[model samples]
Target: MTNRKIYRIALEVEAFPGMPTTAAKLLPLLENHDSTASEIESILKYDPGLTANILKLTNSAYFGIPTRISSVRQAIVLLGWKRLLQVVMTICMSPLMNKTIPGYDLPRGALWQHSVAVSVAAEILVNALKIPDADEVFTAALLHDVGKLILGGFVKEDLQQIESMVTKGITFDVAESMVLGTNHAEIGGQILGKWCFPAELVSAVQWHHDPESCDESCNLSDIVHVANTMGIMTGFGKIDQELALEHFGPVADRLGLAPENLEDMAQQTADRVKKLMVSWA
Candidate 1:
């Protein structure tokens, strides 16, 4: 895990720039608090692929409705708008959200699974706290780790050094800085910002690991951070000796999430993830 290897991997990942979905049109639609079912269906209609994906997902293993859902309108009526929106967004994001970075020992779809679990966990946590705009909360959760696709190879290239630092209890962020020259959080933040996502969502992705630096108390980062740690421990994300237990308790305390409550939230979140994958699949 030398700088040379790290740079080499970073170059490969950058050489093949990703093409994410055109989300701006959908973003405003998602932001519409009072949007009707027809409105949501109309907005997604712009992308036939997105619409087809959603319909296919609604009939997937996750939802398993009694009848097939062959259209956006039918899916919306069957799944409810909130759940339908979640499925649509997941479909919209799936293409760009996938990659393999063996540095983290993540399998082909491992990172995607981890991200989905964490996103669902974050939303569950938000509901337990009765936070407002729960849809927006989940949206932020779903997109938080996108930066990892860009930086995972960089991290993988230096995997050995990262492992070495972890053995000595060094932080991933600190160890990465020492080896990779730039950290994933910074890279992730930059990507989100460049995409012109909601400023708050971008901020959460940027600062998820460090709750103190996040812009707001009720931000999605705090929720995602807790969800991510729980994902690792609960087996959604890959577990490594590199875990920083020091980070979790503080983040939980900051968000007024008690240990018992956090435990229940994690369980519920994992359950929902099972149902969620059906639609995504």
Candidate 2:
């Protein structure tokens, strides 16, 4: 019964409408090193609302631009295409993520805030660790809990059984899997796969809660795991005040982070997330 139910919920990911058209188009472009600013402007111009939000975010204090950015092309020029793509992705994701999530106990905008926080945390980790190949980390971190959107209803239905397991000293995600046959991390990977994301990114989300289980994308998974924990530790994106469930030591060691490095990263992530949320709110 649990397996069948999990299969049904997994199938629902195909119908999830949260990935905006602009985002879908832009995501592929982010991978193309040859993608030009005009190319980005072309896709965004059709979605004026997204363009406007992109401009607003580009001009936000987070980017530290000295001049005002009034146009997409101009913004792209000033912020560079890669940074502009990240901003566009953030704007495109906000509407769906801002909605209140049921089972996770996230209020309207809370999940979005937490996602942004995690994304920021991921960026900080990549820079601090100087992992040059981690360009996909931000997107992976942003969508790590996307499974919650699909699984929330099911979780609500099984809340009592899942909560019972949690009370027995099991972590929430583990309890979720035991009671529901799958957890959000696995479902989140399914969602990303349905969206045609890169394999590494899919792996990163799939094993974010269990980095040790991810072989090929272990480093990426480890970064996202620690980033999600940092988001929770900074007091954003908590599932009903649930503590950071993943152990910090092993993942930190894999990432070559000492305790003091984590403290510094946490402070930087919190400051950056707070500033970014100003425009996001």
Candidate 3:
């Protein structure tokens, strides 16, 4: 199908049921640097479902907080607005990301696993490299492959074509673009754009597969690109190995990281993902 047709279909089906209205409302507010904790708690209070999810996650084994967080206000104060927003987004998006995507050969929860892995890896990179805005990078990494959720059926439909191209040495993203008229990263960007996400986030999702081609200089896209590759390397998901390696050296160099950093980051990311999976479970 044409890209336009695929985009149309994505628009129709992209309104995932798990996306809490409260989370949607809170995104812009959280994006504002000046947004106060009270403001965040006020928005979350009205959505009991969202509040419950946040409380559950904050009190999850992943957080290791001793006392139970019974109230949204308490959770907000404990987590702070930045981390609280991350938890909120994670809880809200989990349902959609956790679903099986047979087209991409991701069984139930596989995509979510990969997403969390990348998010963890991105967080590691942010700290190690001293990159600014940890929360933004983590959020972008978590949603980087959202296009795959939208393009699963199309990827499945074009599986044979995709595999054939891969066998002939073409990368997965290229094969996807060739067969489906658009790749997941671009499709994911469009979906996030429709959700009224920030342009930087949309760019990160869109250009993650090919960060070098991004209109702007190195940014979160480069970080997520390396993180996504690390996630696949650590067995969270599948990708063309050769294609992924091509970016590894360039991205690592761009970030001034050595090969050893990636190896350590991958291990750290796996351990963190394992702990976080319990909450999702």
Best by lDDT: 2
The list of candidate 2 runs beyond 4 A from truth reads 1-4, 239-246
Clashing pairs in 1: 62-278
Give the Cα error of residue 6 in candidate 2, in Å: 2.2
- Residue-level lDDT for 210 in candidate 2: 79
Off by over 4 Å in 1: 1-19, 34-43, 59-68, 77-81, 215-218
Candidate 1 lDDT over residue span 115-171, tens digit each: 788777877777777766556666667766676777676677668888798779787
Task: Write the residue-wise lDDT of candidate 3 on 62-177 in tens digits.
Answer: 77889888987787677776777788778878877889887778888888888888888888888889987546888899999888887788788779989998899888887888
Candidate 2: C-alpha lDDT:
0.82
Looking at candidate 2, the ten consecutive residues that score lowest on lDDT are 239-248
Per-candidate clashes come to 1, 0, 0
lDDT of 2 by residue, 1-281 (tens): 36789778967876887568888888787678688877887887788888878888888888889999898778867887568767877887777778888987888888888888889999998998888788888889998888898888898898888888777888888888888888899998988888888899999999988787888867788889988878877778774433445567888887888767777788888988888978766
* Global Cα RMSD, each model: 3.4, 1.7, 2.6
Cα deviation at 240, candidate 2, in Å, is 6.3
Model 1 residue 173 CA deviation (Å) reads 2.3
Q: Which model, 2 or 3, shows the larger lDDT?
A: 2
